[model samples]
Target: MKKIGKTLKSACVLGLSGALLVCSVGCSSSSESSGGEKTGKKQLVFWDKSEYVTAYNDMMKEKVDEFAEKYDVDVDYVIVNSGDLEQKLAAAIESGNQPDIIMGDNTSVAEYIASDQLAEVSDVLADIDLKEEAKPYAVFNDTEYLVPLSLTAPGMFARQDVWEEHGLEAPKTWEELKEQAKIINDPDNGFYALGLPLGESGGGDAETFIRTIILDYGGEVVNAEGEVTVNSPEVLEAFKFIASLYEEGLVPPDATTWDDSGNNSAYTAGTVGVVFNSGSLMGTLKDEYPEIWDNTAIFDYPAAEEGGQSYTLGGANVFGIFKTGDNTETAKEFISYFFSDTDFYNEMVEAIGGMWQPVINGYDDTEFWQDPDNAVWLTAASNLTLTTAPAPTTDTAAQGFSNHLCTKALQNIVVNGMDPQEALDGLEADLNELYQ
Candidate 1:
């Protein structure tokens, strides 16, 4: 865990594009051709919005060169900011000059699939065994379209020192979590029980928390048949639970407007005893806050009820081929190579740190994740589950996720004093329109 200067702060800016940045490196060219007919060579244009640290980019560039040499194809790779990815890719599509392959967030992948802009990569699916966390984003309309590269999830993490001082163990249920929070909360001294990001600005983090709670409470945005189910008792339960946290002053007072990084920033700044977050926070603690790192321990999301199950909300970075591009085969080949090259893939995964988790099945069994130093991150990743995983109930779930619909409903209840059922009613109406 090398100390990068405020890694999450930089990522907060980059992720404003609606997805966390990963390791995206590419070669650049001015060729406007979408076909594999660039001067008698198999030419492929690839777009990546995972602009991270220079080391990540450099590693990617090395892989690209190796790929070009092995495949005998010319690749035009460009790094684009995720915030601008949608507009840039849409503009290219409109101008009839789109990239052959794109690596992006699940939200964008779903949109491309919905719009029929992506080519099916059944061949790639045939070769790689995707983990359960990767499956939801990999398919569209029962056809494999996305090649998932990595996984991420938000889970409960606590300061072990704080817990030990209070003679407490890591909580395993929501009731226990609340009890523990009460013991640790010290708002006047700038210490909070939990770092819950109830903010509405950063779509992914806020929605991840809301959705996980809804799922555990047996609520879902839609059912298997694509009908809206956002107004269920389970949804109200989840909403009420979140509101209790705010009204009780367990979380920060300014949490209502904080971005996704709010909780991470709070936790890193030593203001929170526990937090539900991705591995990035752990990475920061390991590097910049060594004392905190020594005291940090991660656990699965607390169960919604006694003896009931809970899950971390999973998201992915995926590579998808565009139907508009001419070198679909070449694009697939590149992705296939990336997944098959285990040594390089493992190195890349380690280099990127907690920003990503392996989507491939066996990667977790490896030393990189198995090492004690990576315990917090590995625990978080191991508990990963998609908001709409096992199967998506609605085609619009991805769109709803990007729009932060559930998050807003939460804000309505907690910040505006709206009745839980009333909030659900509005959410249900909007979801009906989306799923219909």
Candidate 2:
């Protein structure tokens, strides 16, 4: 694993946009005195991202309760939606009331680390044995701020019955996908070939899709030294190719306006032949729409060209300790306890339908990962390209991803009909501004 450290050119300044609305789940406030004083017991505030699987949240609540009893601490566990976490966290930081621990995606961690609000937890990571692929994403500037909890990646979900009816097989490359999409697209029958989102809303589904394409086409947002390199010919080609998908009507027309759940909703509704998302969609299908789940087949992301290298964007879902509050040690202890029971952790992952891949080395060899229906997720986790690849995982790149710059550029071309070069130029300027 490579350890990278760099002085970020700029600090990310988060604007306080709205009031923080936190939803508490299985919370206990009895330990606090009327005046908000701790009643001779340590209090730990934890914010967990709401999972798509309700059982995962429920299991975590049970674990938090157990930890509180085991460690003699009062815990206030809040479940925050992934889309609202950044804003709520920003509010908490600005008000000097941040939680002791937060669980979120890598982009949020990088943004917070850049703002100097996260505490280095390298000591906490030392006790856990992590997989080789999970190690690189945990370190920044030779310091660790996030403890990885699980892995997630976007996989191509195709309608097997639809493909079979057309005598087609799952596509293995971008050209094949487009060709198959053209043949199977039946807009008259209310089925589009693909459900690629280009919208700027939600937590960067559009950005993830576009960035994977940019890298697969040999483009880089930045070089290894963290220099801006997005305005090159390769990037321009990538932009044109993506815009061509919308232009040729291969993707849903409203994909430009979709939020994070747009593709999931479309896939569930059987309006699109294929969609790219994590296993959360698969879990949803199995539980709510088993008929559709029965026909859905997951595949690795298609390569940019025939016989070319393929890439998918993903990273570990991590736990970040905040520098705020006096409960840093308490938070670390709870994290250790959370992963202490290897059996329970493995069971929880299986219960969640393997939507959350294991970050520990030996956890992946279990029967759950070997199941054919669940193996694609394991394959994706094994070969993840962190959101900020090519460039070191720096605050600047993280902020760019959080801002959805790539998606915005694609929207400018596909939605507004701006020239691809012009959009790429604007994207370069915006990214350079962030890096500067």
Candidate 3:
């Protein structure tokens, strides 16, 4: 298993002076004015992974500037590459400095919750509305600390022309998807039905897709005892389905080692006819290759097996205030501001090219989604509940990285003739041991 905290260990090791620490937190204030008045604007420092960094450039900076002007508080955005965020946060937490607010993986939120770093929403966020899609992340010990932003997962996409020419409609069931995939797997036509990347990309996609299928087979990642349920007949069914997909030649040969961007490349190169993809991903295809973007069509994941939920695993970005500094109040205010700030939210959507519903209730219906631009993504997140975790057992299973592991397990099953049941069963055992 890949160790998570080894690199972060050095950065987070305590005993270092505050001046020597690298910060992952933004703005917060826990101190009452001691003997003097506070001066200057309250600067809230924030950290997010790299994709959001590009988004901040996409008018997010301007939106913060606008929020600063409107609320009279300076919002400082700290951009960190997504891969390095955990290490940075670990380091910061070690030295008594953490971001005022952090937005990263949905699964990762459990780690923050386990630490003393987070502030319970309590009455502070009581007024903020939440979507059905986001509330599952907050149900820890019957309390919540996160305000969800983006709800994302892969969906099916196709070249409209190919579907029209072949007279194939969107597949709603696994059987149909396989049948359609077989028809489109013709190498002579320069088209493949799916983008095969068995590395991390394939791994994650495979896990979620299979998990949904497992659910179809009456399987779940955990059992009634709150332990793993991966080694069951249901999971075996899920494995059997994936193995069938590979053995039947529905997936491309290079899927086992395809790089990060390989799937999208296949779509852009017009080498694929159908795929499981997302609307947020479309922006790249559009900007880099508008023609491919035009040919692209986004849909939800097809049923990999009969009786499956039209589902994808639950995933979202959660923001939290760290347990550092005297800036706790400032941190809470920023969370409230970030969640409720109308202008900031809009700019966030505009910059990131992804939509994050505002935290306040009913805010999702706030004309923003209805805009022509948001139509596609809004749909992607709409029916996502079918794939979400049952309450009381959400992030605890993965400790914030289950999706990552599941994805990897999927990759193992996709190529190499690995058994899905054995792969998931092993993954379940390891994951259970981590938190056991």
Candidate 4:
């Protein structure tokens, strides 16, 4: 929600390396050793990309320290930008100087696993089904290599005050969203009924926002075969609908240059009624801005047409042990300890402020999720997904495609104004290239 400052304005594939790649990783060499011997306790280096990892890292270290005292092991936690993990891992891949554990995603995680750089952790959390949302990135070559950290799906949110003032509820259908957008877009009153930050690099934010709308309209960004299928007629209609929103003046003109915050800004300022992103925002909103916080509400992606479902995408941060690291067994042991213990998992979540939903807890009793604070996320999680959960389909293809397609493909469409069909066509062609 920080004002769009240093982030690039586009979400294109060419820019994926820039946007999602590590901008800079906060690393510590204290746990490092002089050669093959480690000095301090039986410590292991664990790194992942998450600015929101403060509490989790601390708790992780706490658990590791406890384990270290009991089992004689050391766990030093390091924070890296999500984008940086790939860059650093790519550099360290050939050097065999990798950390004992790497935390990333299926897309990013695949590179390590494919090269035999990661341990097959099938035994670590064998009891964990990992749910579908996690499978896409967690499993590779039918072998599980990662531990899932959270339940992830993008969510839609709005200012509760704006909804009440406009006599609206979360739109159940796409038409209703559009209709609601019309009423909120009374420019004379300094409001936009809806938001689409087009300026986030050639509509990068627009592309993501629009992709959900496309799903609502019956489009699938990823198919069962793990290939991109966004060029279909159903998706074309979705894209055309987006273009129409732009032409109809539903989106702010300045949206194209904005980063993720444009929508956040407008919503918090009461200038816009609705926006879609991670529900994690609710926690931050609660912590920082209290006055307008109560006006917030969560929404499912509205259905396209009337009966269609809304499906937004989300990714999870994963934990993996490197094949080259010194303490391979210990690394896996810590991860096992992390997941098998429910209290430890909750501590991590509480520390991270629900920025992540525990993946292993997918079958978490429906009871706690109904708490007023979690009500919106529970609904948003259920509403924004087309599936019970999202686990990736084509393992190799998913990761390679992610590094090759996912963010970049969407970026191309957003920045290039590449015709939705043509853009996706190009993405398909690229997927074949990676597959080869």
Candidate 5:
């Protein structure tokens, strides 16, 4: 509850400042305006995240250069750190200094739509082969806005060698998962069975994990009709289950304070037997620890009950056009061209590596996606399901995520020793107020 209090205070401060105070820090913008202005070329501003991934940045530069050459546009390409994107975007929106085209986490797109800062791209989507299931975060009020670039399904991963040493198979049911975790729990040697990031400081991973369990149990924070349902019986079961993981000594004590990278570091350090994370963990294991990489295995999140459906929290990154920008047509054309060019898109996907999986309909047939090493994760991505959030409902879900609602509720139980029902009741109250 203390952590939640701090989060609410921080959010309030940010809101008062219009969430733009951090926009100037580490801000860098580059322009290819040179002689293009003299030639009457249109000026297009493009912003993307991931400033540290050299390969991704290089690929983006190459693509932007090609776009400029083909379309006669002066592109101002800005690379913002992903963590800083929300604030930077908020500042840009507040000041009316919007980029023509921007790529961001799918959640941010929902927030932008809530604020009416995005330009509609229904005409662009009509020309493309956008899949129905893939349209959840990209559409609002029956009009398309986001061009989903790629997605990731964060599923469960385990150290195969450890499981083999313990003579255990990957758990298919939540009960079996817990039983196996209890068997593997050995904190005396600095090891734990589960790498659950329950801390609100862990960023969205905790919320995603909690929501995945809730969805698996046939519960949701908000139903299709947009009513707050956090206190449903299924959600209570999910909450008590999460608390049991900690109370039974399966999760490490430090999980209460670990940030977004906590579980990743814990698993990499050989301190955890199983971790629920994105496919990127496979990439890390492959690059930094080949021994573990060879023995690593992935599986879908264990089912909530023996016969229940399995679900993994999923999301995507999207390309969007700003309503305030004057280059809407140019932005739409570039998005269309990027998606339609199969070769270029595949090359970009390769460059992106585990950061995102292909979102297009036919990419499952691509050689890159068919590799044996990617089997587990590819299956996970293909089966990913998302919570429905339409129009006004979408805005509430985005705010819930941004506010770390579920994570806070889990912390209230695990850290503050509050009753699971009470924590859930508080969560329901908060959400009802938010969704209202």
Candidate 6:
């Protein structure tokens, strides 16, 4: 229900102009025409993120094909690798030939908004039936720019049988988790209790993990007023605590070099006792590793304090329309058509097998969510703390996150053997530079 009258247009003009000047050099021509007309028919170009689960991407292709056939439009749908999307998008934007719609994570969406490369989609949101919780994530500066497609969060996947063999219940608090980890962590036997990644190779997993801990310890990188506060006592404590985990050998020795798949591979290979990941890992286990899936129990992150709320770092996967395209209206129409059928939408959500949560309401009665494992994701979706929790969801925070500042700080401490306070001071300086 937020409104932005003319500021949206003015901001878009300023952002697009700046981006064009910055990226005008050495850009390649895009496949589609500027007017999006092909063979005497209107065309729609879409760039979708390649999901971890192949079925998700396959189903999306089916949906796109169906939409194209129904609308009689020439559709150019491309599935791009998530890691390569940012550079590709910038190049397209520079050439003024970006796609009509692009599916991206929250960080990418924030970058688009910051660059004024996205069209305001408040009307698209108003026409759809959205969950109240999904609203905040799409809005910035009192205007909505993206339409959320699905929700995801990181949850603790633990080896239930191992914990049972030791006659222990699941850990409920961070302290309990460490204690349990210390007891069950048998490095000589090739089993580590925590498969947490502290590396910089992956996509923001380490950053997300470190931020979750910082928030857990009552630290804030930037306050609500947008002032840099990452150098506080709470952040120093959080940094020291994370360092202690690596020092105590609770984490794997090679965890320093892990990419996004490092923890997933460790857990799936039966060398790790616990991992924090999205439901994509759950799908992988269910289909390919049934025996391990049977032993796996999905739990929320342990509370930082006893009897306190547990926070998961997550947000929505959204569709953002670029301002550089001429098929904005057609793109919006496709989105409406995509969600128009209740049964089809439900099937899409169920096809991923709990990897995606519903952003629209009225899915409470779905039988898929009644399963205990799937239900855990449903609950975590509602209890998420976004990467920019303490501060507003601004472009600066997103840029900092995309820059992997948090993971770099951890590497400075755990890998480079820098003092925690010194690492934090460096982090504070970097964040303040971004904010300014």
Tell me, by lDDT, which candidate is best.
6
**TM per model?**
0.86, 0.90, 0.78, 0.77, 0.88, 0.90
Residue range 31-145, candidate 2, lDDT tens digits: 2342136566777999999988888889989999999998889899999998789889889888888999999887777688887878898888888888887887787655888
Q: What would you estimate as the lDDT of candidate 4?
A: 0.63
Question: What is candidate 6's lDDT per residue for 148-217, written digit by digit as tens?
Answer: 8988877899999989998888888887898998989999999999998977768778888888888888
Whole-model Cα lDDT of every candidate shown, in order? 0.77, 0.84, 0.62, 0.63, 0.78, 0.85
lDDT of the structure predicted as candidate 1: 0.77
RMSD in angstroms, all models?
13.2, 12.9, 10.2, 13.1, 11.6, 11.9
Per-residue lDDT tens digits for candidate 5, residues 1-436, read 9999999999899786764644433242113234234568787889997733467778887888898899877888999888788789889878877898899777766678777878998888776775555667576645677888877667677888888999998888888999999898889999999998877765478878888888887788887777777788988998998899998899999898877789999988889988888767767777787787777787657887777788766777788899887778888988887777877776776666655667766666667767765655667766766633322436667777878888898899999999999999999988888877
Q: Residue pairs in steric clash, candidate 1?
A: 27-77
Residue 418, model 6: Cα distance from true site in angstroms: 1.4
Candidate 4 clash figure, as a count: 28
lDDT by residue (347-369, candidate 1, tens digit) is 88777776677777776767777
Worst ten in a row by lDDT for model 3: 26-35
Model 2, residue 116: C-alpha shift (Å): 0.7
User: Compared with the true structure, what per-residue lDDT tens digits does model 4 show for residues 101-196?
Assistant: 877654566566667788888887676656554555566666777777765555677777777887887888877888888877877877777776
User: What residue runs in model 1 are displaced by over 4 Å at the alpha carbon?
Assistant: 1-38, 51-54, 375-383, 389-394
Among all candidates shown, the one with the greatest TM-score = 2
